[model samples]
Target chain A: MSINKIQEITSKNNARLTWEGCSILLDINDGERMVFERLTAGATLKVGNKKCSLQPLINCPFGSLFQVENGTDGPFLSRIFSTSEGSNDLQEEKESPTVYGSKDNRELMDNNTAQSLTGEDIDELRRKGASGVEIIEALITNSATFEKKTSFSQEKYRLKKQKKYSPRVLLRRPTARSICEAYFKKRPEQIGFLRMDALALLLSMASVTSHSDVLVVDMVGGLLTGAVAERLGGNGYVCNTYRGITPYPIDIVRMFNFGTEICERIVNSSLTELCATSNVTSVSSSQLEEACGTRSQSNEEGPSSSVPSLDMGEIMISSEDGDTDISPASLAVKPCKATKVGQKAPLDAIKSWRENGFSSLIIAAPQIDAWSMVKELLPLLSFSAPFAVYHQYQQPLALCMHNLQVGKMAIGLQISEPWLREYQVLPSRTHPHMQMSTSGGYILSGTRIFGSK
Target chain B: MLSMELENKVSFKRCIREGDLVIVYERHDNMKAVKVCENGVLQNRFGVFKHSDWIGKPFGSKVFSNKGGFIYLLAPTAELWTLVLSHRTQILYVADISFVIMYLEIIPGCLVLESGTGSGSLTTSLARAVAPTGHVYTFDFHDQRASSAREDFEKTGLSSLVTVGVRDIQGEGFPDEFIGQADSVFLDLPQPWLAIPSAGKMLKEDGVLCSFSPCIEQVQRSCETLKSCFTDIRTFEILLRSYEVRGERLESWENHAGGSLGSRKRRQRSTDGSNGVEASVSATIVARPSSEGRGHTGYLTFARLRCVI
Candidate 1:
């Protein structure tokens, strides 16, 4: 009951909203329309045959629709962001007039009856004042395949036309979902092989609630950290153990518009600092951990513009305990401080870290030894706390699962790859889509069994 | 520090104090949710285990039974709770549940409507997904099942954010009071097509709707209905497989003799228990797919409600 009460009090601020400075994820109407792309305000974009104006006002709020000159016939706006409680004056965008009704059973004409329309005519018509849907109607009437195609192909043809003709552009505040869509579909290499579907499973398997205290060693450019923070909704904490001068994932995290309170909950500490903070430390253990947090800072990427540099006060607490004495020898080899990035992590988070002992732990760093990371972090989890480690290649997680099995530290070890196939649900001809992504990374989820073995 | 452990706040601490729903993990399949009482006993195959003894032990701490057998007293989380809860009907596992939660775009403070509450497994996750600020209005046709789910909601401490309505969603659409209120609507019924109209009506402008069906025929019918009322329609099926791996440490006496580790001991024989032995060139871990792999729960069809001015 208290969890419910706590949730009600906190959920108010998490709703999506739009403003002048908001970083919005726009579902672009291009051939690659399936992929959502990030766009900031005050930047003009070339939409399909049209110039999309994106002038932002000072703290201006965005709404679902806006009326433009001769805009009544265009395709409806799918969505835009606004505050939860307010009623905006903007008019709602209407659905496309050429509705593909499920009951449409019109007989098709023979193939020889009509020839495909010329590209020149379509270009001329588009230059004229015809809407995308209008041009699509012309395409259907002129195309030779129109008469011979099945209902599914007909629908597909219409969609192709919609994408080609419609110059629709939208601006909405970036949520974890949008940020995930932008990265996973657009820049898969940048975020590793982690897909949005896979990320969802990882979060759910870990039971990441609004009140969860989580531990993450995410190498997917801070996606996991931002996602956990979003679910936390400003409650609890996220300990992100890093291996560099600055945390890698902060760039994507800042786009979600998580408030200062939520940002504070995302505690950043070097992997070295984290391993050093552990109550039980050995020379070998510390030496192996050095490979974790002490990355020669890569200043090559330059500073990410959207993310605010973290304050140093949060990072320096680790040294105060002096529990694991900072080795003078290792510090002497400190990588040159080129354009000093983010903040230095303090050890203070360890005090709280020792108390809660993290309800869930996630390792998505494919570059690091996931088994070693799991071994070091197992003792830091609450009893029965679920942890999910992700790797594009199955061998690493397989080894981790084996080590966990041998060490008796984990149970219910599952390696899951979500099989996704989109459906082509057209009238009278529904089937699986022809093309789909085969893999979306692999996940090994299990519980930390801290019981006596 | 003291304030963090408020009576109202539920957290995984070391002890099973009063009001904690401890998950008695017997195995992956055999598990139970036991309410910790001052004088209570959990009688399982392990033996008679008193709740009094478990009251002060840390969660995941192993307590011996009167007959010398033992089991783990683990903390109850949403994911674990899903696996252990008594099944009243087929439920959504973590795989599909995660997919639905993400694609449906449900987040904190979003109002969601769920029909045919069945086992409340997905509902439990849904409740957690929209916690503290969001609420899940769940409806089930069966009177007994609906009331039972409501009771379960109270026991699981989700009553505050979820409401169990005992109306037939397909027969009589979601109560008119919620006609244009829900941020998202979910249908898990035999004829979700009949409920699609109601779902669309209840959804706010540009709100999303998801229907879970096991068969493709049901998916086809649902998509047909959805095309008339929604946009951006998609269908997905999620599969989860587990891998159980075992490690064996091998020592050699003849071929490719392995060197001895740091002068801890002098041994002529091979033992399988020693770990991280430098003398051994590699740690051979044998991994195989686990016997229990849940296949094809259902196809999740998600669509965004078309903005109808």
Candidate 2:
């Protein structure tokens, strides 16, 4: 209803206007266009021929309210300070007699004399210890009066104490951190080993997630994968892979037994592969050792390591070329009963870390096919162990071994998304290998490269 | 001082002293007396309490009057001043001000450019938001209005944030240095379409721009200029409705009646009941009735400069 009244007033004339709680009634010529706008609260209204403006001692809406007034005094202009009729009446009743008839009325009128004051006038008044009310009164008194009924109309009402308004800083609700914490609490068991990139993705998802739904992340960045594993309750596995030949197999066996059960199994298998591949003219044990040293050094200094770690078991696995005569099955050295070795392997080790009553599968692989094989073997070995996959150069992918289906779903969804199109390192000249179809599965048409360059 | 209980059922805690007068609460139904002893008592039906009671209380506190009515004792915050100040025109609301602040990135040490100081609501907000630093230069063609705005600034202790001038922004652009020095520019006058070129001259390379208009046609024209002058131009409206949040019954009166209905048929019946119409009537009428039903205040268009080049 107030909005309608405001609209009516604004539309009637092109005068700029404002509204407080009440409508301002301004005396303007009919159909005359005047600009209306807001001043700071407690702003005075300049009226008539006076140099000073009339300061309404009440809060009014910001905008101009217009109306036509006819008088012998050349159509004098007056703006309504407020329009709350009841309050106006009450104020009028209290101040009318005193303002009009009191001996101090002369001083009030003197104060009300409309005069134009510059910034210096205002400063001088302040220097003289004048209050805002006093300064406003002085300005009003000094200003011109274009209307003949100024005395009666102005004297008819008393100036009510103006209520002061100020700006406010709105308090915003808590951010995504609280919500993410709540989500993690609601399903503690669903969380697995998280990597840095995975954690970042989770944070992003938390930013947009509603109260419903569990978060699933498919980690595809190496050390970043380890970082995430640490943040999500550290109850998963770390998987690593190595490749080489001969005495390198011996070093791989030493590294496999160096950790837990899963770690030992992984190291033993890699050593066997190295031994079998040592006979190959193209590879040597010394080269294998050099590759291992290089991978370790790279992991220590990179953005890939920024992932928060989740406390979990680790299964270190490595592979290497073995002597051509050594059967791949013999190359499978299960360091413990908990470790599982597959048949079609050049040579690999499977070590399981089953301490603290939680099994974690850490798989380090040089090839996508090897990683896939480890993933397939995950459910059979330990359904609850969280699995971490580490790959150099390529995006490391991992899933909670216990929640195999969810892990698969997360990978499927990510592969279908267009996030890869924005990758900076990808050669732009070549057409993208993955395309998002209308139905949402990625239409893959190019050769799939796995493992580090 | 009479010992009589006031007819409005307001009880006096003490007598008024010299230079002190009792003030009644507007919404209180009962009469109560407050002692004006240099420290006056704000009395009503709620309870008789000393002004000292609210001295340290934060703004937005609900103090009880002598007659048991609740009186919201708002602190002398900038927003409260805007709520109570006299305006010669329509004023900007907190919703609009919030967006303007965010879009403009209004902060200390920035020069703000505004046109047509109407009620000075935005001006007050800008003043306070950028206070202790920053400056606001507002222009209006009417000398009387500008003077009035100047008075308001004096009262709110925010005259420093603003510089009121009597000039038409459309006639001549702000001075060269003033133009390029401004961090943000807000246009709240009619024919804001005419002020865009001035905005271009005045705004910095990545300065923010905003235009508040009451109609879509005005918005369309403003947008055209904004597209050429700035980049990342976006327009949005903010609607704020306060809800009575008391315990589990947090609800808004506007949405209470028809908000929970899940079925289309039931919703139709409810709508029909309110409008006295049959279900067979067009759904368009039920969904959106007429212009009268719309909250036709104005449209706000915002833009940001990507590069001067």
Candidate 3:
């Protein structure tokens, strides 16, 4: 009956529009800052020094844009409708490239007097009810070097001022790619430096599909678990197995707007329980209950929650003190206690896994040695099932690959490193980003073969 | 390649059955898709192998040829199918394919659109991502290529999830019936800018679109067109560098000098007994990037449809 209820909810929730309790990724000032928050009535998002309620964003669709405006009450986020003028400007610029000035910046000076507007003057303008755009215009009119700059630099100057005066927030859905990117950008260590490209490779290498049972060792928080669960879409089980009775903390799963159906499919079981001989089911069930008890106790302690060390108050305070460049921080403000995920795998599910074996396996335990762990876990997968192991360092995966080859337990073994480089594709200036991630770690992928035994 | 039905799933009891499409793997790079019939026999570099020997065996079984050479019979997965599919056009490899799927935010029950069905390499993986509940409508200009892709999807058991049409999307855009119904659209065409307007019309609010091109000029033009109705446009080039691993034993030169890392004591004993080899030899697993690999694929530019409502 609960499964049917969740199925009904899944069909209703297409995940296109934000709801009262849905999670959202807030991209502030075009990725100058990124924050994660729930869309409850009381949830507040701080843009610069102004803390505004997120109520206006509740019913809006993902990819909607909101601008921070100084309302009668205070500063608030207002929805920004798309305008055709932006595209017209771009089109005109493309058509008339020669209209850009040939002037150089040789006469430009680095002196602070380029802008006559002071902090107090800007505050005074704000008090006078001058909009952000009006203040920008006033500043430009008063600037001594406004006419001396090249057209390109003028556009750059305007963009810089826009970011500081009128901040914009773009609502983004927290999919696996966006979630991995957020963590990878802000806190790489939390997710074991698993870049989005590397994460995608893991999913593909393991062949995660609907209706396929997936076994995972998600030590890099809950990123791998949530990703597999998203691909499964509530059809099959994503069983997270651990070395001991305690399972890894998968708080990242909460960031996804997975309905009750998808959440129910994400379960956990210890390695011993999954590999326990058939006769030992009764003893393992008792152990499973014991593990469940400890898990709930840990959850109460709150150590197994969202990304550790995300201090929302500190980021807001730092930005409010006129620190323009604020390092992005993941803020989990009262994550609505939605349906529970990562529950202990039921006895039936465990028994079924033991009999049928998992369709595929993905291991992202950066702390564990790949060879030792894979040696213990590979047999739980059905013959011909693919597996991918993630590690920040290549030596571990290399040794794992060597051992697998020597033992003849797997075939098609290869260790791969993902190279991801972003480009700035502009009209006349298209090049790779000035800085890029040197490495996205390594993965050892192979397919399990039936041992002669 | 996918288990659509529970009974068809790979399990301890699920054996190689008739009419099964299996990937015959000789090496990591050497693989072929084979349709198993009762009287089917396969001839390869190793030797002649009879299909009857593999009928009752489970997938991943190592079946020996008549001349004693052996190879593996693996249950087909989308990844392996990509490697074995016929190259009707320049196909997308795993790196670009994986990145595109993730960046597009595709999941189950999502309607996806693609163009140029180039060899159906990416389409196979796309079908896997949106299987059992979703559908993929892919169009190509070449009728022969479209038909071949359809047959390939049929062989891989993905026909129910994908529909291949013979239409030049760059010239005629997508079918009008899919207006505002697609969760994501992917364009891998020479002139993707020609299809940008239709793609914008077909996407639901906030739906994502990705364009793959090998040249920066195309990307430049597409971004100009996308600025009208898309937001958060970003471009990335993704590649995979494979490494070869080997267990190598290195001999220490200091062992010849009779002192290093406490090996002197062991060397003294071994020189009087054996050849003093055991003390200096150390076996360790080492890995390095393969000397040659794909240097360039295409740049993936992803953008989200701006929500106007």
TM-score of each: 0.76, 0.33, 0.90
Whichever of 1 and 2 has more lDDT, that candidate is 1
In candidate 2 the C-alpha lDDT for residue B117 amounts to 85
Give each model's clash number. 16, 166, 0
The global C-alpha lDDT for each of the candidates, from Candidate 1 onward, is: 0.64, 0.36, 0.81
What's the distance in Å from true for residue A434, model 1? 2.5
Please report the candidate that would top DockQ against the real structure.
3
Task: Quote the lDDT for B68 in model 1.
Answer: 90
List residue ranges in candidate 2 displaced over 4 A.
A1-453, B1-70, B245-294
Per-candidate DockQ values are 0.29, 0.01, 0.44
Tens digits of per-residue lDDT for model 1 on A307-356? 33221111122222121211111000011112122222333445445555
- Greater-TM-score candidate between 1 and 2: 1
**Consecutive 10-residue window with the lowest summed lDDT within model 3 chain A:** A1-10
Q: List the TM values for chain B, per candidate.
A: 0.85, 0.65, 0.91
Worst 10 residues of 2 chain B by lDDT: B1-10
Residue pairs in clash, model 3: none
Q: How many angstroms is residue A263 displaced in model 1 relative to the true structure, after the best TM-score fit?
A: 3.3
Ten-residue stretch with the least lDDT total in model 1 chain B = B1-10
- Candidate ranking (TM-score, best to worst): 3, 1, 2
Give the distance in Å from residue A286's predicted Cα in candidate 3 to where it truly belongs. 6.9
